[model samples]
Structure formats: C-alpha cells, structure tokens
Target chain A: MDRRDFLKCSLAGCSLFLVGKGLSTPLSSSALAAPPSQLSRVEARYYQKLPDREIKCELCPRFCQLGDKERGFCGVRENQDGKYYTLVYGKVASLNVDPIEKKPFFHFLPGSEAFSLATAGCNLSCKFCQNWEISQMRPEQVRNIHLPPEAVVETAEKYNCPVIAYTYSEPVIFYEFMYDTCLLARRRGIKNVVVSAGYINPEPLADLMKVVEAIKIDLKAFTQDFYTNYVRGELQPVLKTIKQIAKSKTWLEIVYLVIPTLNDNPEDIRKMSRWLKAEIGPDYPIHFSRFHPMYLIKNLPPTPVSTLEKLREIALEEGLHYVYVGNVPGHPGEHTYCPNCGKVIIERYGYTIKKKELSGNKCRYCGQVIPGVWS
Target chain B: MKTSKVVVITARNVFSGQGLPDPRVVLKMFRKGLELLTGASKAEEALAIWFKPEDRVGIKINTIGRRLLSTLPETSITLGLWLGQTICREDNIIIWDRSNEELKDTGYKLSNTPGSLKIFGTDTRGAGYTEEPIVNRNIGSLFSRIQAELIDASISLAILKDHGLAGVTAGLKNYFGAIHNPNKYHDSHCNPYIAELFETDLIRRKHRLTILDALKVQYHRGPSYHPQWAENCKKLIFSTDPVAADAVGWKLIDELRARKGLPSLKEENREPVYLFTAEKLGLGQARLENIEIVEEEV
Candidate 1:
C-alpha cells in the first residue's frame, strides 16, 4: 500500500482485515471496514421474482423492482443473481444498552433499560436524519459487528436488559435480523421494540407486529409535501403503519420532530393531532421532538422550544391525552399528564423517570387507564 | 448554446461464440467515435485535447451483471490500453468498477502490474471509497478513491441496458458504481440525484468521455440478463455530454422495445426523466433534435 492509501485506511478508524473470501483475519483495528462484498446470500422475504432475474421488494411502499446486482433504496438489501438478500442481515452496526424512554416509549417500560441495536440503511432518506452516520450509509461504509440473532439475545440476557430495542437506524431495513432476534428474545422472556420512520408496507409491518412488543414511529410531518421533498417517502404509508400498530396488540407511540418552520406549522400540527385522536385514539402518546440541525438539513436552526410547547398545547387542545415534548431535557412537558385528573401520571426528567404515579396501567391519582404496557 | 454531439459506431458480428469481443473491431469503433466527436484528424489527437500525457485515466465500467451482461472485458481493456498507448502512460490507466469479485465475475483478470493497464475495483486492498460523503445538491455519497483521488481523468465505459426504475442505464449511471451507496439514489426514477451526482466535483470535474457498450443490449427486463430480451446489436455509443449519451441510449432501448412488441419506457412510465432533469441543470442536452447523432459502420 502507498503512503496516501495507508493514511486513508487509517482515517476510517477500526476495521477488520479480509483473510480470504469468507474469513476475516483479526488484526489490530486500523483502517477502513472491509467492503460488505461478503454479503449474505439468504433469500429475502416479502419479495417476488419476476420473469427475468428482477425481483420486486414488497417490504416497503417503494416496491423496488431490483435487477441482479442492484439494491433496494434502503441500501442494505440486494437482488443478487436473481434472488433477493438483505446484506445487513446479522450485521450489527451499532449496539448499546439505554433507557427504554430514550426510544421515547413513554408509555411502555418507563424506567427499564433497552438493549439497543441497529444495522445500516433506512428506506427513507430523511434530510434531518439525526443518525445519518449509520442510517444513510451502506453496510460497507460503516464499521459492523457480526452479531447473530442468538448472540444478540444472549448479549441482552448477559447485560440483564429486559427489552431488545432495534433503534439508532431504521430497523425496517434489517427486517430478517430484527424479526429473528425478536423471536429469539421472545422465547427467552424478553420483549423487542422497534423505533422506525414507519415507512413500511402493510404485510411486513403486520408480520413485524407479531414479533415486536412495541413500536415507536417517527411521523416526520403531517403533510405529503414534506414527505416528498425532505423525507424522500410518502406520508400516507407512515400513517397507515401508525394506524395498523394502533389496531394490533403492539404498544404504539408517535414522535413528530418539529423542524422550525418546515413541519412545525400550527395548523398542520392541529390537523395531525385531530387525525391522531380520531384514527389512533387520544391515548397513544405523541411526542413533539425538538429537531436539531443535522444531516443535510444543517442550514436550518434548531426547533424553538416554544414551537414544541405550542405544538404540544395544540395536540392537548385537540383532545389528545398523551401529548409530550422531547429533546429539551428539563422541559416540564416531558412528563405524562393524567387527562382525567389533570395530574402528572409519570414524571420524567429526560430518559430518567423521577416518579411513576401509576398502578398497573391506571393513573394513581384518577384510576384512569393509560394506554400502554405496564406491570 | 453549443449543441451536444453523440456518435453511434457499430461493428457487425464483433462478438465471437466464445464470448469475447474482437479487440481490433472495438478499437476501430473507439477511434472512429472519438475522431468524429472531436473533429480531430487522428484518434490520438482527439484524446490529447482532453488528457495530458501524465494524467491518470480511470475507465469506469458498469459490471454488476457479471459475465452474461456487463461491459465486455476485451472492449474496455482495448480502450484503456489505447488511452495508455496514445495519451497517458499504461501504468496510469485503471479499468475499474466497484469490487474485485464483481470485476472477476464480469470476466476481468485482476491486474495491478506497473507499466501495464491496471484492472481492479474500488474494493482493492490499497483502494476504497473516500472518507466522507461529498454532498452535492440532492446527492450525498462517498465516492470511490479511484474517482475522488487516484484518477485525474475519467471515461465512463458503461453497458447499455434497460433499467426497471431509471428506464435506461448508460454512461452517466455508470458513475453510480464509483460511489459507495448507489442504492439510495435510485428513488424517483433516479431523477435529480443522477443529475446532481454527476454534478459533484469529484465526477463532474474529472469526467472527460462517455462510452456505452451496446454489443449486446438488454432491451427489456434488464440491467439484468434475460436471454429472450438481450439483443446483439454490436454497437458502441460515444459522447462528451453524459446526458446526451444516455438520451441516445434511451432512444435505442425504446426502438428495440418497439421491435420486440413491448411498450416504450414512456408508456411503461419508467422513462429516464433524469435526462431532462440533467438538461435543466445545464449538464447537457436531453433532446434528440439538439444532439447531432452521427452513425458509422466501422
């Protein structure tokens, strides 16, 4: 290797060396991650092979009709020699143990830690993607650990985490791995949770619901224009996913990241609040997340704290019970209020729950049922 | 405004039954196309105008489809060796794509010998993508170091094929392989992103030529191999304008589709509208009326 080439490799941080075809020689980490050319050949689910070697991915609304050597928009799945495969399968890019509330599942397991994991690639190309390091990259672009589904469950068990959260990046892109991990986690008396953009199709989402205990959907905006322009996706599919999750036994939560003037228009928030109250009911906790300038949307300023508060007020005024504000750590709006008793049911300081005024899903102050999984 | 010129050079029965493209015939097509496009007296003169003797040339070929359908190795190496022999040093020219396995699968013998035409991929041990994604308008991608740093000049040697989403794949789309994440840009019929990606300084500044290998065009059900739809047209398309080259490729695909009694890309609603988008961005000409199509039988 030349001097410049070695410098480039070293700049990529820690990387494993490829020994041959399938084997990677464990050397000291220095250099770029090996090209994910060593992709899994396992055929993907929810896809149909066409007349030629083309395959149509029914995983999301994109319905990517991929040719051989072509990948879906998600950047993880590939149509290799006619059969479709998820390249990021069992390839974990990021892993950590964090509070379940960090996924911001305010209603489900408030104080418990979630064993978080993510693979690279997301179906939607959100301009303001906070986790773009992993989400926007191809599997080879990022440093990855080959943690199989069984290993993931074992690691979570070893860490004493009750929930295995598929988060940081879009879990939908790594469906097979997440599904298998969820199944394995369930067998071991552990729950699985998904944090996604909800840019998924009905069949896959339905299938995913059977495995996951709860799902947190990031509803970026209320309008279709925002979806088309900024998200590179359709808003209707996310709406459908939210409605589907609400219908299923899976606990559902929504997060609308208010990005200053982009998606924080009061009328749009009001419209979204009303739609949420009518479609998924007023009980599903909707968090108005504060958007910090990130990814491609760095030119925009962070969402004003007042904007998030106002949106929270509009949702509450629209008769939505579980509206909350996110990101601004010490904001009083982070706490879940009892709609009936006008009392703070679950007082939280960021991801840390300070106190829980609840008795088995019912608010301790008013005996009102809070719609989430509580033990 | 200066009109774009695209050349279509055909060498009838250029491919042998053993699946090798005739080097002499392919070289003749390349020389003729360049001579016509640049209005130069000789092929070497045509190349010298765009490249310096010391320039490192990267002949980027689309080889995702393996052996059955990809830019024939003989044709690409012939052009690379021609460039090395004429304008640049043989050691400086690289015939590359995305990965070594893909290059091998496409029937390329991996070579990195100095004083010889180097054939490798971005995934070659000493080569990979740039550290950061070069963001350009709608495109944010990590470019291959071969395109971003190693090469001083580029020639897109792409295989002509009908894409399911982009409607047509040619010279401009060939650069997709030069980036780390091409899968993300395939949305919206590859509109805006394809144009925007080509606009990136890494590609736009370095790219000098577009050569589409239409030896066996996959007219339908393609970008992949479907023998029933593969046509042995035995042609090579050339242009300085990337969009105009792909636009000509789109027309050729539609013509083949019509002959096979299949719907046009427009009728199929997967028309590579990216050409129009590219034109609007002032990259090149999208209209056939504006592009002077020079046909030759070499």
Candidate 2:
C-alpha cells in the first residue's frame, strides 16, 4: 500500500495485507501492534564512554555527549547507565511499497517497486521537512511496527520488490538498523538503498558504504548560512558525505529541494553543480525537487515552477550530465536525456514511466552508453 | 527600572540520612520561598498573585534524570499540594513531565483522580502533544496538551543542574519537556532556541512562576546524575521572572563547581548564554545587578 493508506490502516487497527506476485497474504496484526512503550535496548555501535556515566555518540556530526538516562539530538539513541543504545533498532515507524521513482532515483531501477521503511527520528531538523510527522518524532511519539532486520528482508521478497529502501526519514540516524538490514537484504539477493540528508560522520559513512547499493542524499543547500538557519546542520559535512559516497562503489544521487527565497538562489545552484562536477564528476543524477509548504516553513508559498526550471537549467549549464526537475508532472525536464546523444532516454510523468528510449543501458537513438544501474 | 526579585530558601536538615527529603521541611521551605518572593506575609497570598481559584495550574517538572537527579517527589509534591490547597483547586493542579515512564522512574505515583492533585505526564492518554506545531522565532514544536490546552497557567518546577550542552538547565530550559522535539533545539548551546521557545505564546503567556529545585544540585557533568559533582545545598529558588530565576541557578552551580575545584561554566565556554538572549527578548533580567536577591532560612 501507499504511505497514506498504510498510515490510515495502522491508525484504524486494520489488518495489513501484503500483496506480491498476484497473491495476497494477511500480515499478522501483532507484528505491527508492538506497544508504543516497547523500545529496543541494542547497544549502539559508534560511541565512546566518558567519565561519570556519560557517553558521546560519534555516529553523526552532532557528537551528542549525553549523560545517564539522556538521549542524543536524534532522539532515537539513548545513553542508559553510561551505555549508548539505539532505541529504534527494530522499531519501524513507517512502512510502504512505493515506486522507486518516488525516491527520485531517476537512473536506478526506473519504474521498479521498492519496499520502503523508516524508523522515527532524524539527525537534521530541517524547517521544511516533508515527513515531519515521523522524522521529527521520537520512537514513542509515533505508532510503530516491530519489523526486525530479517523480517524486513523477508517482507521485501514477499512483496516481489527487488529493492529495499530506507526512506521517508533520515536513514543516517537509524544507521545500526539500516546497516544490519542491508547485510541481511544483500544475503537474500535484495538490493538495499538509503535516502538520507547525509549528515553522518566519516567513520560511519565509510562503514555504511560497504553494505548499501545506492544512496540518495538530500543536499539541503549550497551555503553554510542556509544550512545553519534552515537545516540546523553544517554544509561541509554533507558535502563531505556526497564526495565520499561518489568515490565508493555505491550509486549516489543528490536531491536539492528548491524552497522559495531559501536556498533557491541560481548562483548557489551553479556553485553546487560546479563543486559536484569538480569533485564527483557529472555521472551521478541530481534531482531539483519542488518544495511544498511544510512543517515550520508554511508561511512561504509553494516553490514557483519557474524556480525549479531555472535551477535545473543552471545545473545542466554547469556540466552536470543528468539533471531532472521533480514534483512537477508532465514537465519536459522530468525526462532523462543521454548526455552524449542529447536524446530522451527515459520519459516520465510523475512516478510513472510513460516512454523509455533506452536499449538496456544505452540510448536507443544513438547507442550511446548512459551511466546508471540498469539491471 | 525595577529589579526582578528572586528568593532562595534553605532549610536545615531538609534531607534525612537516607538521602530522601523531608516532606514537611520541603513544604515549609516552599512556603517561605513563595512568601519572600512575593513580599507577602503568607504563602497563600503569594500564590494568589499569580493564580486564581478556578485556574488549572500545571507544574512542569524535569524528570529526565529519573530518581537520581530529577525534581524529587518530596519537593514537587509538597509544592503541588500546597498550590492545590491554596489558590487553585486540588483537582486542577497537574504535576507533569514528558513521559509517564520518567514520572514513575522518578518515584512519582500516577494520580489523575478528580478533586485531588493530578500527577501524570504529557504522554498520558488524552494528554498528548498539540496536533500542529507552535512556531516562534527559531522554535517550532508540538507543545504538550497540558501546557497548551489543559492548563491556564504554568509553573516551571525544574531541577537545577549543570548541562553539558546548555551550561545550566534551570527553570526556562525545563519547559523544553513541554515540547515534542526538544532534541532538535540543542544546537549552539541551546542559546537562542531556549529564549525563543519561552517567547512563544503557549509558554510566555501562561508561565506564571519559576522554581528551581536546588535541594541537591548537579554542579558539573550533568543534566544526568553524577554523584561526584552533586551538592546538597538544601535550597529552593523562586522567582516570577523566569530568566532571573535561571540566572541565579547558574550562579549557584558555579559556586558549587568552584568549591569542588572545577572550572566555572564560563571558563568551560558553556555558560547559559540563553539567559542573556531571554533578557534581550524582554523575558526577564539575566544580570545579577538587575535582580534583587532575597535569601531566607526556613
């Protein structure tokens, strides 16, 4: 089911049915009925114990130094009696089956279904977070289902989904859960992808790169000022994460949500495109997503369609190979054009693939090779 | 310019050998602190200044530290019951925190009986956070229904502690528990966010008093329980000006840290700059020169 249907079903206490390969099976309600108070006590991976029952979480850039019975800035990890633990280890706050295109990974398995899930909590507090209902809440604040790593992989297989996406919320905060699930999904022959704001520390990012196949990083802004005011994060670390992911074996895509008067400057987009070209080259696709009035940023109007079109043009001009406009259906910018042939290789309207001119991984018009995972 | 008045009340033998506070002595200290704070002859008269007979008063307590460093049950219950017996009805007084688990862990019995002092957390059924975020400058969060709708007035009965991030988590910072996403506000030593959160209409309009539960103060390495740095100062700080109350709490922590041969919060570069931000927002006086100190032994 879609995200809205899943939420409605979960809230109404209805039995969820898993549909796959023309067969449907009832998912046990008990699995999704874990008491809100029940949280995992798994010891966290990246943390150092300090004196007097204090611990410093090293997973994110925040490096939250917490005392006994205190939580990190993510609100999912807690330090209990000097031991750091991930409280949301198996707590799935949201689960959905969505088109891989919804993750906006234009070049990765286009039109394929993705088994997506997310735990509550996020490292960054973006002012316009679209999924604030789950991302900005603690594990206890949201309704959750206890889907362990094995169950997550099994459910992906049952749903005939080739890819498992750690999405909706920032996957970086749920690193332990995502990492473990990635390993399990890999062993089960299912691909694992992550959608995050990329506010992670280098050590954890390095380790995470080994397991996940693709990562979609939401590069919030180009300048540190926007990162500080609107995102409550540092721009340097996100840039570092993007550079790291590009160098790794994993596929990387960047999404820039163009909010009105906030990080929508064409100059900044040019600089960002230049930086990406200089550091990571032009192979990776970058989606300039339209920003809606969400969360704390409701005062501003929806990002003007012209703004998205203009930013996309700026990136394309900056030598980026793949630049697509998002959230605006039937826009010509939604199509993926072959950099060499300059022909539309993949055409789309919203999340659906209306027409594709790609022969395997090549452009059908000119037989030019396109960069993406096309299996 | 009138200086904000702050009262510090200390009682001898407030705690027994078991490290538990004496309820009777704690109640007496509250009486003296409230009376001295309002310059009233009686505690009831002092409470009447801020609360009415029909007002539903919410006592927001800091219980994240559980039993070790939380606002102790003896201290908060005595004050809560006293408020109930005075200006407000017993049933209308709610002594609450962020979660029922915290309240239970901190030695509080869950009580929501009518015509009696109600004790629960924001997570209690029918008492969750607001549906929409209450947005202020640099602050947007879902405030607890208790703070936003259930109560007409609020009193921050917060535990005085040395916070590693905020420098000092006192009366003003305690209201962080009232919001759902307090974790999101810890950036930059919780500076402008703390001040900005208090400036919100839900908090600034309803907040009536600030009471720092300083019977045992965490001088360093705190917001968590650290026995080595904890001090038994046997004090309760009271003020109508929330910023002035927290500023005084900050000074008391520095004094305790100094006696223990530790660096001051300012030296550590984590002194609560939020107090100054609050003062700039016209919340209260953050400077000692702008505050009138009234100390008493009960």
Candidate 3:
C-alpha cells in the first residue's frame, strides 16, 4: 500500500485486545502528516554516462560500469532501465541517538550526543562485517523508517543532539541520504559527521567534504592483500581518501579494526601509523578497535587487548597525537590523552563520556591545545 | 576410480520456426541422453535407479538473464512433464528457481496445482530460504526452501553459457540458485564455494541429476545475452554425476570458443577450476577422459 492509504488505515484503530500487549494504537491527524516526501535528490556528482544506457559510477574506486537493471558492488545504487538511481535515498534502516564517543570520534565533540542514521548495503564484502544484518543486505531486505533529511535534522534538534551522524552501515552506500542530510543539518545549525569505510572516490569525497563537519573512516586493514582477500576492496583508495580528507575543511579521523592474525601485525600497524603521521599528520585520531569474530570470518579469535595496546603504543611512538583503543569498555586507551602533556583530556567508557578534563580546546591539566572540535 | 558417464544429445529442429522449443523433441532428447548415460534400454529404467515414484522432484532452471538468455520455459516444462509422466506423479514435480519475478521473466507460468505439474520459485512468500545456514567447506549459506524443504530430490536443469568470472556457468554452478547468496560465492572465480555448496546435505543428499540446456550456447561475453556470440547448438546434456556433466559442458564451451578462433579458457585465464575441486571432493569426475560422453541426434 502507498503511504496515504497506510496512514488512513492506521487511523481507524479500535480497542482490539486480540492485537494484545498494547499493540493497537490510534493515529492522530498530525501523525499522518503526509509522511514527509523528503528525497535526497542531489545529482550524483561523480558518474559518467556511457552509451547504450550504461553508466560508470565514479563515486567509489570500484568504478562499477553498470548496464540496465544492474547495481554497483554496493547494492543500494542501481541502473534502472538505463538511468542510475540510488535506491537508498533517504531510506533509514537504523537510527539511534548516540553519544559522539559511540561513533568513537573521541576527539570530535567529546561529550555531545549525535543523531546517528544508517541505510542498508555496503561496497566492501568484509567477511568479518559487524553490521551484516543491514550492511550486507539489499535496501528492500531491511525495514526502513522514513527519516528523511528534514526529519533527521528535526529529530536531532528535538533530541538536543548537536551532531547528525551518518553511520552504522557504510555511509558511502547511502551517499545521497547522508549528503543531503548534512546540507539540511548544516542549515539547521547542527553539525554533520559521517562514519565511512573510506572506499569512496576523490570526486564524491570532495563533494561530501563541503557539507559534512567530520568524517571517521574505517581503515579495515593496512595492506592491499588484506583488503583484497578479506574486505573485497583496495587499500590505495582509502589512503587516497585520507590524503584528500586531510586537505579538506572536514575534520577527518581514521579507525583501524585490529583483527587478530589478519591485520594485527605489529609491522603493518607501525607502517600505517608512520604513514598517518607523515601524510595526515598526528592530530587525526587513529582508533585501534578490537575485532570479534563475525559474519564469514568467524574462524579467528578476537584481537587481544595487548595487541590493541601494543598498536596504540606503536602509533604514539610513530609521533601520532590522538591514538585510541575501542570496543574495550573500560580500558584506559578509550580516553583521549593530550599529545604534549600526556594527560587524559576526555575519559570515556565504551560509548559513554565519563569526564572531560579539557577547558575549551586546551587540556586543563597542562594547558595543551588538543586538536579537535572542542567547545 | 569414479564411475559415471555423461551423455550429450543434440537435435537441430528442437526449436520450431515459431522460436518456441518443440517440447516433444526436447523430451525425446532428454530420454535418449539419460538412457545412453546410464546404459539403460529405456530412459524410465535409468530414472528408476535414482528417483522413487513418491519423490517430489524439483527441476531447478536458470532464469536470471530472463527470456532472451535463460533456461527457456518450454524446455523446463517439458522436462518436468516428462519426469512426471515417465518417472513420478505430475503433482510431485516442481520446476523452480530463485524468484517468481525471474520465473515470469523467463516465460514460466507459476503453478501449484494439487494434481498437476507445478512451477514456482524460492521467493514465493511461504517458500523463502531456510533460516539457518548450512555450512560445508568454504560455503555458508541459507538454501532456498524450494531446494532444502519443498522438494525431496533435485535436478539441476541449467543453461550452458560462458561466464565473465567463473569461465563457464553450467550444471554444477547452476546450484548457486539453490542457495540464498550466489553473489558471495562468485569470489575467487567461484573456486571451492561452487564445489562446497554442492557438498551441503540439503543439495548433496537430494540432488539426483544434472541436465544442461545447450540448445543455444552463448560461447562468449555471456551468462548475459550478447546476440553476436549466441549459437543455437540444439543440445541437451544429462548425467547423474554433476561434476562430469559440467565438465562435459565446459568442454563444449571450450570447443565452441576454439572454433570461433577464441583462446582456450585456460589461455584466457578463466577456466572453471571448480570442477576439479568438485572432483577432489568426490562429487563426480572432472577429467574429460573419465566421463563417457555419448553424443546422439534425436
């Protein structure tokens, strides 16, 4: 049924106890507020139209040349009878009012709550995909709530959330949703943050940087071999994205999921840390998150706490400023430490921010100016 | 040593001038192929070796490419009817694939008649994939209810075509439809996954036959229809051994490719290595010499 009929049918609610367990509800006239036809109709900026109704999506490094009725590696976007269409435009699969620390964006807006939203589908088929229930599915396979761009901003404002986070499933798959949401959020004086896998192309990445406030890229692994064998993607594009985001006004942070044996190699971590320090400079926070066996890659054990700590030490030794360990609830590494004075600037436990030892942008302990969106 | 024979039967007039396949000729070819492959005097006797009269048989057809390049409805329906008439009850037969939409695209009329032949797909609301995963070797996927539940025995009635990734998609690769996630198995040129999926109990226990519809072989740039490469070879291959059947199908694709002055699949670096993997897993014979192919015109 269409949205209008569905709304009308919902309003004729009776006190049917058979529906039981407080199942039946009467919809107010305002509850049927036309369901908001909020579409993120931003013309995709990085696709080249080819002859015979084909188009090569330059949005990501996959460079998917799709024929009619075909989708890119990311199942959300489709070539509908020759025209390219993002099926997940404004299709919100999951939404939660999460603290900024939950996005593990420890450096960016440490204590503030962010309204996070995600649509189904992802570009890379990582065997150890955490959000496979949504990310690995087609847009139609998931239950989508109609939280369009305007509605998203309004919800954030309603919840007193300062930031709107495009997260959970890879935001790159729902590019149009996140992009337009960022634009709307920006107009409403709300910040926009994106959690991505950094698998996007330069052109789209450049366009995204214009509206979004911060972007946290999940660098799945350090080597190309791991990217290919495990993640079904390339590491070069991620590196390129890091370089591009570093130049942009958008605040950039990188999250490296330290999977045991697969990518927890100290040598690779050291090299990655050095690259981050050399290229993006030390201020950009690199998260060495713990990995649990998930999806297809369930054979290996989770990364040991020592391994994450060791990686964190390596990053710090490599002159990285804002390195953090994630997924370990009460670990000391979860807190953000000041680069100069080596004091806990922001204490965190899992998604919760316990304390902020910073006065404005500077650490209260040693008056060291920590580089992030501190207010 | 693996003891199995693959029979290939071809008929030039399998398709009438109206572009629809003559079901009678196709049925005759199927019978001939089965009889020769099993060294049975009659096709029904050969079928009796594997299938019981009470078995609910599912003829799994490839319909992803739609009518232009798919296992034609006429061919599948004919096989289903023949199996019903000669081997089992009409009500006990089901010609199926992944989705109803795809079945319709390939010109199949969906049926669930109580006392007549039925045609449906896994995406039939009540007949979705099995909720739990069946893990075997490199494969971990939820098999379609049509494959895992509804049918007692399975027949992979596939269309012979060149694949962009797997070199060739034939009888064994056709079982990709039996599982919910064919997309995941496409990695590594469908190496161990293809072989392993066939090893799953839902498939390996129930699968009885492999019949490749080589009536119109797409020699190159295929699995999708590119008219220039399509050839109406007018053939149907049948075998109890799934790997041997696909091995013969691969040889046919290679033969066509070679005739067109195209490089061998090995030279093109896209050979269907899954056959060898399947052979190693004891699914069937992958080596060309092990399969006794009997080619005949019906």
Candidate 4:
C-alpha cells in the first residue's frame, strides 16, 4: 500500500504508527503497564576476549577494549564476564511505517512504503545529530518493545510493505537485530535496506551486504578533522565502508548533510566527488542534504539552498551520473534527470514521488536505462 | 604557592570477614578524614566549611560495579548520615548513582522518606536528566536532575579503581554517572571529556568535596571487579580539590600495582591524563609535588 492508504489505515486503528516530527512513538498500553527493566542479552558478533575478563569490541573502528561490566562506545554492547553482548538486540525503541523515499533511496522502489524501526544507541556521536533523543541514548534510557525478528517480518508482511528498513538511528549498532530481521525478511520474499553513518567494520558490513538489497550511507564529511571534532569517528573507516558497499552487489546511495561552515567546503566536495567517481564509478546517486541546527550545534543556521545547489553542481561537473538536493521541498534538484536525454525521469517533492516517466528502468522518451531497481 | 591538601584516613579492619565494610569503622574513617582535610577539631566544623544547613547535598556514588566493587553502602551511608547530622537536613542529603537497579544491586535500599535520609538514582520517578543538553567545551550532555537541579552541593563519593581506558576511575570520573552519555565520552582514553565534563558549572560550581572509597582498590583490569588483581587498601581519600583527590587515588592504585609486580598505568599508556587536563583548567592540582597529603590511621 502507498503512504496515503497507510495513513488512512493508521487513522482507522491499524496498529501501525507513522513517524512524525517528534521521531518517537508512544508506548503501547501493554508496554506501559509492565515496563521492562532488562534489555536484550544476545551475544555480539565481532569481538575478541582477552585475559583477565576483558573483551575488545571489533564491531566498529573504535575497537573499545572494555573490562567486565563495562559498555563499549555504542552504549548498547557490554562486556559481561569476558563475553561481549549486544544489549539492544530485539529491543525496538522506535517503530514507524514510512515512505521508501523517506529513507531517501531515490533509485530504489520509488513511491512504495517501507516498514522502518530502530533500537536505541549509536556508535558515532555526531554533534548535530537530528535523532539524538534515541540515537544518543542507552537501551534503558528509552522506552522499548520486544519485537523479535519473526515479529518484524510478520509486521512488514501484514502492512503490505515490500521493504523493511533499519533506519532513523545508526543501524550498525543494532547489527544483530537488523541482520536477523533481514534474514527472516528474505525468507518471506521481502527486501531489506539499511540507513547508517557507515562507521562499521568491514567484516560485519560484508555479511550485512549479503542479506540486504540496498544501503544508504551518511557520509558526514571527507576530512578526518570533521570526523574527530564533530562525529567522534574516523573518516577512513567510513570511506572504506562506502568503497566496500560499492564493490558489492548491494545498491549504494550516499547522503552528505551540508552544514554551514562545517562541511560545506566546495573544494572538499569536489575532492569527494572525484574520489567517488574514481573509486565507485558514477552510477550511484548522491544526495546533498540540508542540515538544520540540532542537538549541540544550535549556533549555526540552517544550510542554504544555494549552498546545496552549488555542491550538487560541483558533483555533477565531476562526471557523476545522478546527484540531488534533499530536505528542501519543491526544488528542481529533487527530481531525477536522465543522464542521456536530460529529461526529468522521476519528479519528487520531499518524501512524495510526484511523477515517474520511466518504463521498465528506462527513460520513456529516449529508452536510456536508469541505474536502479525497477519492478 | 600553597599546595592542595589531600587527607587519607585508613582503618586496618574496615572490612568484616564476610567481605562487607564495617559501618562503625567506616564512620570513624569519615570523621578522621573530614577533620584532617578541613583542619577542624570536630567533623561538624568541617561539614560547615563546605555546606550550609539548608543545602541539599548530593553524594554521587559509583555503583556500576554492583556489589562486587562498588562504593559500598556501609561507606557512603556513613558519610551521608554524618553530613545530614552535622549540616544538611536528613531528607536533603541524597545518596545517588546512575540507576536504581545498580543502586539496589549494590545493597542500597531505595529511600525517599520526607524526614529521613534519601537514597536513590537518577532513574527515580521525579529525578530524570535535564531536557536540554549542556554544552561545555568538548562535552555536551543532559545532566541528571539530581545533580543539576535538586542538589545545591555535590560530594563525589566514588569507588577508587583502575579503569581500562581512563587509567584510573576516581572522584572526578564519578561525575560520568551524572550525565546521560558517559559512553560518548569514553573515546580518546577519556582524556579531555572527563576533565571538560567536570569543568561544567553544574559540577564545578556546586562541587564541594571529593571522597574516594579506597577500602578495596581494583588495581588491574578494572573498573571491573577482578578479585585476583584487587587489593584491600582500607583507606578513604578526601580533598576539596577534585583533581588532587583522584591524583592520590591514582597513586594508591599504582602502589597496589607495584606490590603485585604489575606495570604502572603510565607504562600501560593510559595514565588518566584527564587529571592533568583538569589541572590545566584550574580544577585542582594533579602533580604529586603540588599536593600535601595527610595520612592517619583511625
């Protein structure tokens, strides 16, 4: 069903909620009546146990070596008696039925609805995190519902959403849950997609690529200084992740949030475009998202539309195939223009797909094949 | 220049045969530590120097280690009761940590009686974190309302242990429990984040004292409880300078490590450099030569 039908069904008490401005869901009556004090205690995937009851987490580049009872930088994984456990597995903190375009996969399954959810916690702490209420919190700090992998897939099927998205907060922190749900969703003929900051290890990302169909990475910046001072992460690892995803069969899309005076350097954007063209080719789509003052970055103003347009122009000039501007409704850059005929193949306004001039992954006017999944 | 004074009060039999602290001996140590730290003949005069009678004083305890290696209830309750009896109202004295579960696991009964001593955590019904983030230098977090709004003065009654990242988890590091995102600050070996978090006005302005519970020092492979590397030091460190108290706590951990033929924290390349950062921020003295340590057996 489309988002309009989904909204009408939600209004008719369909037990599904739409994600709105707050980015949070009210606790169900059952969850509120008996709040769970304990979080999920599943064993984490990538970690090495050391001597003296200590364990080093290998999930992210941080490699947080923790003592017994100490949590990693993600705040969702902990070391208990020399064993690393992910405390957020199956703990659904936020649930929403959103449009596929909200995940901003402009090239994948346009105008369809996606069943999206996220657990509490993230590996990277961005200074301007938009979803800090859930992303920057531990599992215990947020209200959660116990939705196992089976339940997630079943809900997606019930809601008629062909794709399930691990989004909102960083999905890599909830790797186990997302991986398991992807596996389950695959068995039921459903597609899986992930939205993340891409601050993940290669091994986990490789395994994730095998199960998911598409991945959208938030490339915070091109410089290590921006990663250190603002993102609390490393740029090399994120670049590595992007390269790895591009090499794999998974469809890749990139989003660069343009902050005022932070990462809006045109030269850096030129460099990033050149690098992406050289390493990953130009078939992938890149979105220059507008950033607003949020979390700890209230000092700066919202990114100007002119800045995004300039950055988009630079990326297009660098021989990139598809580039777009995001978070700005009704901008001409929101539409997908064909590289061959230069006609707008797909028109969009925010999360809504206004029109599609495509016939079976090809431009209807010129028969130029577009690089995306069109069924 | 006058050096910061740090008082170490020791008791040989502070712990009972069952591995719990003795309340009576812990109370004696508090009395002695307060008297020596303040240069007052009595502990009541020492309490008055830091707190007013109407002040709501918060004793921020470290309970992440649970019962194995937390700031024991016997030690913190004695200090809280003493502070209540000497200066603040009984109900105004709060003994708290990050969560009610950890506090309960560490043998702290949840209490909020109107005319009695209050013991709880930041997770209490009316005591969550502040809605907005407080930005201070590189640190930005929502502080616990108990530390930010409820209490007029704070005493970091923390467990003295060797942290895997921070080199030493002591008085100043205890304030990590007061923020909502301690995990975010664990990067860069917790260097400037720990010091910067303490430099925030919610901590620096209201902080009145530092009390390190060094009765059982986890000298190696800690902030966790590893009995093989644990040592019974039977000491409580006190200082008005938050950095000096943690610096002394670090020394005591090094002393314990030396006794066990282990490398110093500096050799391990994780030397709690936040102490030096704290020193630079004018929070307190981190160098050993800049501190006057007064030791006495109670």
* Number of the predicted model whose lDDT against the real structure is largest: 4
Consecutive 10-residue window with the lowest summed lDDT within model 4 chain B: B122-131
Interface RMSD, Å, model 2: 5.9
Tens-digit lDDT string for candidate 3 (A143-214): 555556766776678668899888878998788778888988888899999999999988788888999889
Task: State the weakest 10-residue window (summed lDDT) of model 3 chain B.
Answer: B123-132
* Models, CA RMSD each: 5.9, 4.2, 5.8, 3.7
Off by over 4 Å in 1: A1-37, B113-115
Least lDDT summed over 10 consecutive residues: which range in candidate 3 chain A?
Answer: A27-36
Query: DockQ of candidates 1 onward, in order?
Result: 0.44, 0.47, 0.17, 0.50
Can you tell me the DockQ of model 3? 0.17
Q: Could you tell me the fnat of model 1?
A: 0.49
- TM-score of every model? 0.91, 0.94, 0.86, 0.96
Please state the CAPRI-style docking class of candidate 4: medium
DockQ winner between 2 and 4, please give it.
4
Compared with the real two-chain complex, what DockQ does model 4 have? 0.50
| lDDT (C-alpha, whole model) for all candidates | 0.86, 0.88, 0.80, 0.89
After superposition of all CA atoms, the RMSD between model 3 and the true structure is 5.8
For residues A1-375, what per-residue lDDT tens digits would candidate 4 score against the true structure?
765565444334324344452344543211111122578889999999999888888889989998888888888998888999988887877788888888889999999888889988899999999888888888877777667787788778887999999998999999999999999999999999999999899999999999999999999999999998999889999999999999999999999999999999999999999999999999899999999999999999999999999999999999999999999999999999999999999999888889999999999989999998876
> Between prediction 2 and prediction 4, which has the larger TM-score?
4
Instruction: Give lDDT tens digits, candidate 1, residues A182-246.
Output: 99999999999999999888999999999999999999999999998898899898999999999
Q: What share of the true interface contacts does each candidate keep?
A: 0.49, 0.49, 0.02, 0.51
Model no. 2, DockQ: 0.47
TM-score of chain A of each: 0.91, 0.91, 0.88, 0.92
Q: What are the chain B TM-scores of all models?
A: 0.98, 0.98, 0.97, 0.98
